[model samples]
Target chain A: MTMYNQTTDERVDKALANSFLRQATRRATDRLRNNKYKASAELGNWEEWRAAGEAIRKNVISNLDYYLNQLIEQMEKRGVHVHLAKTPADAVTVVRNIVSEHNAKNVLKSKSMISEEIHLNHALEEDGIDVVETDLGEYIIQIAGEPPSHIIVPAMHKTRQQVADLFEPIAGHALSSDTPTLTRFVRTQMREKFLRGDIGITGCNFAVASTGSIVMVTNEGNGRMVSTLPRVQITLMGMERIVPSFRELDILLNLLARSATGQRFSSYTTILTPPKNTADPDGPEEYHLVILDHNRSEILGDKLFRSSLNCIRCGACFNVCPVYRQLGGHAYGSVYSGPIGSVITPLLEKDWKKWGHLPYFSSLCGACSEACPVRIPLHDLLVKLRMRKTQSGHTPQVERQIFKAYRYFFTREKTLRRALRLGAHLQRPFVRNQRITGGPPPLSNWTNSRTLPMVAPKPFMQLWADLKNKR
Target chain B: MSNTSDFISNLAAKLGRPTPTQPPPQVKLSVPQYQLSSSAERVSVFLQNWQALGGKGAIVRSEDETLQCLKQWFGEQPITWFKENSKALLAWDKLPTIAESAFSSLNWPLTRYSQSAFDPRDRYSIAASAELGITGSDWGISLSGTVVVKSDPLRGRAISLLPPRHLSFIESTKIQDNLFNVLEEVAALGSPPAAIEMISGPSRTSDIEMDLSIGVHGPIEVYVIVIDH
Candidate 1:
C-alpha cells in the first residue's frame, strides 16, 4: 500500500535538512525531558513507581483476554455498547454503520493514535461525513491534510507563522503569529464544531476493567468537550489499553503526565462509564466502546514483542529516542512512530519484508528503553527483529556467507589474530584520516552512515597477549 | 457485533491455547502512598497543589468567607454556576450573571438522558459564549490537588470546559488523600455517574513552539473555593 512515502534514509535526510524541525524537536523534547526530571524527582520514589507501573502493565497484558472480557462485561452491565473488532476493516465498518444509523454528518475527534492507524478520518470522509479534529494540534494537522508527526503534539513541526498561515484562510483575515492568537483562533473555531457535532470519537488512554470506565488524559479541554458536548460518543480503544483498577492508574498516570509534559497532572482527566442516567443533565446519551485488535493478537502471543503493548502512548519514548530526534516521526513511516512504532508496525503488517526494515532504523542507543515508563526493552526488541528477519532468509546469500565467515574467525583467537594482521594490510588503501570511509563491497555498506575505525598497527589482543604471557 | 468468545477463541488459536471459561484470579496490588493526617491538612495540601498546578484556591470557614474569596479571586466575571437545586447553599446576590448555561437547553429534569440526549445541532452556541463556569466538586484529591466533577443536568461538562475561567467550590469534608481514595469512595456509593472528571488546573496547551498557553478550549483561570464550614 506504499505506507512509507520515502525510504528510511531519504526520510532521515529530509528531516536532517530541515534545520527548523531539528530546532523544534530539540526544544520540545528537551523541555519535556527537563519537566520529566523535575516532576519525577518530586515523587521521591520515581524508580519504585516506574517498576510498579511496569509490573501492572505486565500483569494486564499476560491475561489480556480475561481483562478485556471483564471490561466488556462491566460496561455491558452498565448499559454500554461494546464492540470487538478483529481487523481494521471490521473496525471501520462498525464505525461507518453506526454513523449511518445515527445519520451523523459531523464527527469530532480528540487525539487518538489508533484512529490514525485505522485511517478512520479517511473512511468517514469517503462516506461523505464531515469530520473535524478538536485537539488544537490535531485540528491544525487535519486542516493541513497531513498525518500527525508526533502522538502527543501533532503539529510539532509547524511554526507559529505556519500555524497562523493555516488558520488565516479560515478566519478570512490576517492573524498574528503568536501562541495566544493562534490558540484563541482555534478555540473559537472548534467551539462551533463541538456544539454542532453529532458524534464524538475519542481515544481511550486507560480503560478500568473492573469499573467499566474509559479514561482520557488531555492538557487542553478538548477531550472533555468532545466527549461531553456531543450526543453519541464513540470511544476507539486498542484492546491492550486496559488496567485492572484506578490504583495502577495512579502510578502510570504520574509517570505519563510527568514524562509527557512535566505536569503533576494533566489539566483534565476524564473517566466516562456509559450512557447517561436519567438524572445526569448533560452527557453522551449513546456510548459505544470499540475494542480493536488489528493483529495485536500476534504480538500478544509472541514472547519477544509482547511488552510493546505496555505503551500508554505518552510519547515519552519518542522524546528520548536519539534516532527519532534526528529523523523525526514522519521518517518512521508508520501510523505509530518512534520506538514503539518500530516494534509494533512490522508485527501488525502482513508483509514483514516491506515493513521489516523499520527495526533496523535504530542505532541501538537504548535511550527509548530507558525513557519508557513501562520499561519496554525497545533496543532488545529491535535486535530480535533483525535476527528474525535474517533467520527467515530475508538476508541476501552473499551477506549471510560473509557474516558466517566472520563469525567463524571471530570465535577463535588464533584465526582472529591472523585475520587482523591480514586486514591491516588490506585496509591501507581505504583508510582516510585514520577512519575507514571506503573499503571493499561488504564493508562499504557499514560506512554509509558511519566511519569504521582504522585497525591499530598492533591489535589490542596482541598488546595484551604479551602481558598475559609474562603473567 | 462479535461475541466475546469468538474474539477470544480467535486470539487463543493464534496463541496456541483455548480460551479459559473460568475467570482469572484478581491480583492484589499495593495502595498508593499518600498519607495525610486530617481533612484540614488535606485541604491545605489541595490548595497548595492546586496553586502549583496554575490554578487559584482559597480555604474558607463560612458562606461569607466563600463570598469574600469569590470576590477576591474572580470579580465581575460572568459565569454559569451549577449546584443541587434541592439544597442550595451559596446565596445568589454575589453570583455573577451568565449569558447562557447548560440548563438553558430546553429546561432541566431531562427525565431520561437516553430518550432526549443532548443534541449538539440544536444548542451549538450556548456553551461557547461563557467567560467562566461555577460548580461544586463531588470530591477533592489532596496529593494531586484536583477537584472531581460529575457531569449531570445541573452541571454539564461544558460549564468547566467552554469558559475561559472556572470557579469550583469544594467542601472541606470531601477531600481525599490520593486518587485511589476518591475512586474507593465513589465505589462505596454505587452506580457511577455517566461521566466523572478530575480537573487539576485550568485548561492549557503547549502545542505552539512548546509555549504554555492557558484557556485554549476551556477556562484559562481556575479558582477553587474550599468551604470549611
Candidate 2:
C-alpha cells in the first residue's frame, strides 16, 4: 500500500507539530474556500447542478455494467483495446504487459490518483523502466520521492524555496526561489522528457460512454504532450469514471472545475478518441484503456456508504474539512486524505485493524458533504463506518467499559443523582478557573485534552431561593 | 484481462441488479437554461473572459483583416507554422521563413520517435524557438473563451502548445452561445475527431505559495482572431 510511514495518530501529531506545514495548509485552504465561494456564486443554481451531478453519478453506478460495456464496445470499434482488472495486482500486470510489449524503457505520465492507489510507479521502476511525471507539480514531487499531498496541487506542501532546491540539483546549478523562475525551469526540463518518452500514461477524468472518448482537464499542457508524443497511450481509470453523454459531461465539467479550482473551466480540456486514425498523424499508434474494480464492486452493495463513490476527486472536501485543515494531507497516511479518504480507505482495504482509525479522523461536521460537488453524505458515512467497526469488536475495552458504567448510572434516577452529588465533591481538586484542569486516571486524560466546566454545586436551588426571597 | 463479463457480473451481483446489456434512457428534467443573447453580447463576454483568463485577442471582420492584424502583430518577425495552405490556416503569401528543423535544432534531450537521436540539453535553450504558434479553431465557446482545435497529420498538437505566444483563428459563426452548445455540436458528429483540444487561456498554475503564474507549460500569451463573416 502506498501510505505514510507512520500510524495515523503519530503522523497527525508530527504534522501538527510542524508549524510551517500547519500555516501553509491553513493559508492555502482559506484562499481556496474564498475562490470556490466566488466562483459558485457567479454561476447561479449551483445547488441544482450539484443535485443533478449526484443523480447522474448514482444512475451511472447502478447501471455500471451496461454503461461500461457500452463504453468498451464503442471504444473497441474506434480501435481502442480495453482491459478489465479485478484487483490491483491484476491491473499492474496488465499495464506491465503493455510496457513489456513495446520494450519500453522511457515512460512519461500525467498525474493519475488511481495509478498511485496501485503503486504503479514503483512496479514500473522495479521492472527497470524509468518513468517521468510530466505535470510541473507532479514532476517536483516525483523527483523529491514523495506522493502528492493534495490531489490538484501535488506540491502544495512544498515552498518555492524547496522547489528551487529540488530543481537546482537536477539543473546542476543554483536557482532562485521565485515562482516564475522555478516554473520556467520545470517547463524547460520536462519538455525533453515529454517528447522522448516511448510510452505515455494518464488517468481519465471522465470517460464518455456515449462517445467512446476520455476527457482530461489540466492547467499545464503536459496532458496534451504525453498523450500526443508517445507511440503508446494508456489510461488507467477507476471503473466508475463514466458519464453517459455529452450533456451530462457538460454539467459535470462545470461542477468539477468550479469545485476543484474555482474556475469556470480549466486552462485545457481535451477529448481524445482512439490513439490515431488512418487519416491522422503525430499521435499514439496503440491505445489501451484499463478499468480497475479493486474493491469498488463491494462498495456498490453498501447502502449507506455507496454514495462515497460519487466523488469527482475535486479536493473541495479537503479544503473545508476541519480535521484535514489541521493535520494536512500527510497525516491521513494514505494517497487520499480528508473526509472522503476516511470513508473509503477502510472499506477498500478491509483491514480495519490498520485503517479503522481513519473513519474517526473527521469531526462529523458535515462540511465535507456540503462542499462535495456531487452532494455525497460523507459525515453520515463516517458515522456508519464507526458503528460497523464497533460491532466488529474493534472498540477498545477500557472505553467500552466506561460507556457501560455511564449507561448503568444514567438508567436509574436515584443512582444518577447520587453519582452527580459525589462527583461534584470529587471534581473540586481538578477545578481551576471554574473549569476542570486536572482529574484522576481516565478523568485526567479527558481534562488534559479538553476543558470541562465543573458542575456548579446546587446553583439551581440557590437561584430558586433568591427569587423567592426577593418576591 | 479477463472479459468484462466477470467484472460486470461481480458489480451487478453487489448492486442487486440483473445484468443489463444496454443502458436505460436518459432521465429528462426541467434543466435550467443558460445562454448568451446576441453575437455582439457574446463577443463582449468572450473578450472580458479572455482577459480574466490571462489571454488576449482582436476581433476582425474578415480573414484578410485577421491576416493583416496578425502581420501587424508580428511585423517581419520569423514564425513557425504547420502546413499553411489549409483552409483552416490561411495561406501566407509573403511571410517570414518557416523551419522544417528536426528535433536536433530543438534543445530537448529526449525524443519519442526512433528517428531522432538523444542529445544533451542546454540550460538556456527553449523547447520551441519561435515566439509564435499559429493554428485555427474549429469552434469557439463565448461563455468561457474556449477555442476548440482538432489535431491531424498536418496540424500537430505541438504547434499550438509549444510556442510562448499562440495565435488562433476563429470564425465568428463558429462561436457558440456556451459550452453546452459546443458539446452538443461535438456530440452530433458522426465520428468525432481523434483529438479535440480546448485552449481557454495561457497555461497557468498557483502551486507555488498560491501565486498565480501564467504560461508555465504552453503559451504564456495567446491571441484569438475572431474572423466575422
Best by lDDT: 2
Which stretches of candidate 1 lie above 4 Å from their native place? A1-3, A396-398, A408-421, A456-471, B13-23, B74-124
Model 2 DockQ reads 0.42
Each prediction's whole-model lDDT (CA):
0.78, 0.79
The B-chain TM-score of model 1 reads: 0.76
Best by DockQ: 1
Model 2 chain B worst lDDT run, 10 consecutive residues: B94-103
- Deviation in Å, model 2, residue A107 alpha carbon: 0.8
Docking class of 1: acceptable
Per-residue alpha-carbon lDDT of candidate 1 for residues A212-253, written as tens digits (9 for 90 to 100) = 888899988889888887789999999999888765677777
Residue B63 of model 2, lDDT score: 42
